[model samples]
Each structure stands twice: as structure tokens, then as C-alpha cells.
Target: MIILVAYDISDPGRRDRAAKLLQSMGLSRLQRSLYAGRGGAAKARDIARALERILDSETDVADILVLPDHAWSRRIEVGNGRARVPGRARPPGVHIA
Candidate 1:
């Protein structure tokens, strides 16, 4: 399965923080606010829990989409740039719980 996360955050700081958090959690950034990775329900739950702490309920919204094997197999890409894996790179002095 594949897990995709996208967010709309009002605060620049929180938005950047969320991106770093997602990267550290093993998701690859497909765009500025979109990410995709391989994970299950447990992993998606974990991500939601982590994101909740940094996102403002009133102003921020994060969407986590799950794609089954069949759906992922028919995926289409029109861009030349590939998804870049962030590989444990996190913000300085930030400790992810």
C-alpha cells in the first residue's frame, strides 16, 4: 500500500515543520506539500498523531490518502522530476516524538 499526505497550513513555520516531520517519518516529497510513501494503517495513524501536535485545528488541514496495490499500479506521472526521498533529514534542534 501507499500513503500520501498533503497539507494546507496557514503558518509558514508550522508548514515547514510539518514537511520536516513527514520527511523524517520516511515519506518522500512529491511537491512542496505533497508526499507519498509505503505504509499501512498503523503508519498512517502514527503520522496523523504526530501531525496533530503541530497543526492548528482551526487553520491547518492535512489529508492522508491510502492507495491500495491496484490503484498504485496504474499511477501516472507527467512531470520529469522524481519523488525525492528525504532519508532521515530533519530540522536542526527539532526532536520528533
Candidate 2:
């Protein structure tokens, strides 16, 4: 399973905290506010809940997308960056480990 976590935090402190939390969960940063990792359903839910708790519901927004192996296989990339999609052949420069 692959999990994509993205967040928008209004406060700089909270934003950094959120990034750190995600990193601690073994997620790799894909962009300033985007992260991806591999985990089971339970792990994904736990991470989502943890992120939700760290966020200010009134001011922050976070999204967690779970992609099964099949869904990830259909992903297409066209650019100069790396994408970590588990259980799939990655494009050049892409890293999935």
C-alpha cells in the first residue's frame, strides 16, 4: 500500500511540525507540502489521525490518499522529478524504497 499525504498549514511552526511528524513516520518528502510512503491500512489510518490532531481544523487542511498496488501501477509521470510508487517500475530518477 502507498500513502500520499499532503497538507496546508497556516502557521509556520505547525507546518514544520507536521513535516517532521510525517518524516518520522518514514514518509519521504516529494514537495514542500507533499509526502509519500508505504504502509498498511491500519498504519495509514493512524497517520491520518495523527495529522488531523496536529492540525487546526479551522485553519489547516490535510489529505491522505491510499493507493493500492494496482492503482499505483497505472500512474504516469512526465517531468524531471522522482516519484515513489511502491510495487511498480519507476521512471528514471524515481526512487521507491
Candidate 3:
């Protein structure tokens, strides 16, 4: 499965920490606050727990979205520039939807 991890953290320090943590967990950065990678349900749960430990519930929000294999196959790419999905080699210059 493909996991999409996104977070909104108000504090710069906490945000940087979260980003580093996510990278350490094998998630690849997709955007400033968005990460994506392949991981199982167990991994997802572990990641959530780890994130929760460092994030302030009062001011920070984070989520992990699991994209099914079927949905991944049906993903649409609609731009001229290409993006790469973690752990997979895809054609260059297409954005997966």
C-alpha cells in the first residue's frame, strides 16, 4: 500500500522535527508538508503513534492516508512535469492523482 502522510504544524521546530521523523521512517517528501511511501497497516499505525508523540494536539494536525493498490493503479497523471512515487520507478513528467 501507498501511504500519504501530511501534517500541519504551527511551530517551526516541531514541524522540522516531524519532517525528519517521517524521513527516517522511510517516507519520501512529496511536498513541503506531504510525504508518501509504501508501508503496511502496522507501519502506518506505528507512524501515527510516533507522530502523535511529538506533535502538540492543541496546535498540530497530522494524517496518514493509505491508498489501495487498485486505486493506485487507477491514478491519473495530468501535468507536463513528472513526479516519482517512493519505492517505485515511474515514467518521468507525470503527476499521479
Candidate 4:
């Protein structure tokens, strides 16, 4: 139930705003422009909805990946020295909807 949230926000102000909103929703800043959290489907949905509201105010592209429990233990890392939570069992499964 660890969710990986990534953002490609260009505006610092809006990016900070979005980060704050996500943090308020129980997400921890795991790396720059990346967030992590553990929650159920309802919480995930709520976070997605709130993220959309924040992203709507800007031109940034934000994505959320609901990582399954099985992938939580897998050791995959991103470029910025942060471990990657399996975003999807299949490639390009980023939940933007």
C-alpha cells in the first residue's frame, strides 16, 4: 500500500503548494519531486483528487502510482538516490486518472 507520487512541476511556487498538499494527505517527501505514503484505496483516491485540484492550477504533470504490497520489498532505485516503489506491475501504469 505504499504509493509513489512523482511530479514534473516547473513552477517553484506551485510545486511547493502541491507538495504541501500531498504532505498534508499523509505523504512523506522521499526525494525531490517524489513522495511516498501507505494507505488504502479510499485514501489513495482522496490523494489523487486533491492532487488533481492542485495540478489544475498549474501546467505541471503529476503522477501517482499505487504500489502493491508485493513490490514494496523489491529494491529498485531511481536516479536521485531514492528507492523506487513499484509504480506498476506493467510499465506505463502511472495512475493519472
lDDT of each: 0.80, 0.77, 0.79, 0.70
Worst 10 residues of 1 by lDDT: 88-97
lDDT digits (tens) for residues 1-97 of candidate 1:
8898999999999999999999899997776788888898999999999999999999999999887866765665544343453343231222324
- Model 3, 4-96: lDDT tens digits are 789999999999999899999988776678777788788899999999999999999998988886676665655422344444434232364
Worst 10 residues of 4 by lDDT: 88-97
Model 2 segments more than 4 A misplaced: 81-97
TM-score of each: 0.78, 0.74, 0.76, 0.70
Tens-digit lDDT track for model 2 on 1-97?
Answer: 8887889999999999998999899888767787778877888889888888789999999989887866655665554244443333242332344
Q: Point out where model 1 deviates above 4 Å.
A: 81-97
Q: Pick the candidate with the highest lDDT.
A: 1
If both were scored by TM-score, which would come out higher, candidate 1 or candidate 2? 1
For 10-82, candidate 4 gives per-residue lDDT tens digits of 7788788987998888787766788777777788778778877767445678777888866765635434332
Ranked by lDDT from best down, the candidates are 1, 3, 2, 4
Candidates sorted on TM-score, descending: 1, 3, 2, 4
State, as a TM-score between 0 and 1, how close model 4 is to the true structure.
Answer: 0.70
What is the lDDT for 95 in model 1?
32
